[model samples]
Target: MNNILRAKNLGKVYRVGKIDIHAVRGVNLDVEKGEFVSIVGPSGCGKSTLLHLMGGMAKPTTGKVFIEGTDLSMISDGERAKIRRDKIGFVFQRFNLFSALNSQQNLEIAMQICHNGNIDHQRIKEIMKLVGLENKLQHKPLELSMGEQQRVAIARALVNNPLLILADEPTGNLDSANSYKVLYLLKDLNRNLGQTIVLITHNQEASKIADRKIEMKDGMIISLS
Candidate 1:
């Protein structure tokens, strides 16, 4: 299908005892295959909440999330988990790598969980090469720079060759130079490999790397360009 993801009137509401806090409201979105789209917004504007809903990490309180034409709200939690593992690759702001595991091992765990089958060593190597971390495969998180660690995280995400990648501020911990490099790497993956990506960021300059930019505020999308 041309659209890898679709959200229909999606909403998420948190019950804080006496009050209901609406995080996402009436969001309708379509993400085409191989498109690099970024969701940009200020803190507390519901960008992360929206991403969580899209990734199937959190179920929406209202409406539905359709991934590869499958309705998330209609499926069981286990089914949704399977879809998250097999179809969506998530890159978070924190590297989230195991402290003791080397870059290669970190990726191996992800592959093991998602593939639920034989590990593909060649695929792992290719993804490491793609992220320019072939040499650092044996190094643990402490041995690598923040940018390299993030690169390892990215490589881990790509190892599965998923239908879509959801990166949530993957460069948030880096310096300007590292952020620039990471952003371009994502851009290159999208351009050369036709990797579909949806990134969430509050940095306006960083959001420019995306093919499409979506702005959100007050629990809703304000603009998409």
Candidate 2:
């Protein structure tokens, strides 16, 4: 299979006052097409930083990242933004839904972002139904439970039919039951739809669902299995 995502010599450094902290250190990885990969570690181990770099949300201090053969570090900011909007869907730890908008409207906004204001209501309904949110389309974020809110967020991510989904602690805020629901939804997307996914999490259950598990510690990948 071709590589959907690749990072070579990836690194990130943060400067705080007089102190320089290395967040990632010369890490290298490749995610094959249709593969579901997990990055797991304790806090401050650079899992999130690595995810950001791979997703083109943050530039690496050194080396390169390529998404579907496009070198992210070589692209202009506008081009990178376009790639993110059209090719990548992100599910953040926070639901990040607009509290004022209903579930359908929230997904419509994402469609608009992806399609440059040509909202596709039919596609929105399709993705909502896929995520089991068709019944709650009119519910606002405040009206839904945490699990429902996360489902909406996942639906928003899927509305664009992105080639890659980057999830950062997607179930971090949910209880065990809700977390399992979210994880199973992701697994279903991979197993059934063949969606490429790179997930960052501290939850062992979340990581166990992945096809491969990579353990990171102190800014380096310690083991990959």
Q: What's the true lDDT of residue 158 in model 2?
A: 89
* Residue-wise C-alpha lDDT for candidate 1, range 1-225, written one tens digit per residue: 798899999999999999999999999899999999999999989999999999999999999999999999999999998998899889989988998999989999989998785688888888999999999889999999999999999998888888999999998899999999999999999999999999999999999999999999988998989
lDDT of each: 0.93, 0.92
Alpha-carbon error at 33 in model 2, in Å?
Answer: 0.9
Per-candidate alpha-carbon RMSD to the true structure: 0.9, 0.9
Provide the TM-score for each candidate, comma-separated. 0.98, 0.98
Candidate 2 regions exceeding 4 Å error are none
Query: Candidate 2: deviation at residue 88, Å?
Result: 0.6
Candidate 2, residues 1-225: lDDT per residue as tens digits?
Answer: 388898999999999999989999989999998999999999999999999998889999999999988999999999999989998999999989999999999998888888879988888888989989888999999999999999999999888999999999999999999999999999999999999999999877689999999999999999999
Minimum summed lDDT over a 10-residue window in model 2 is located at 1-10
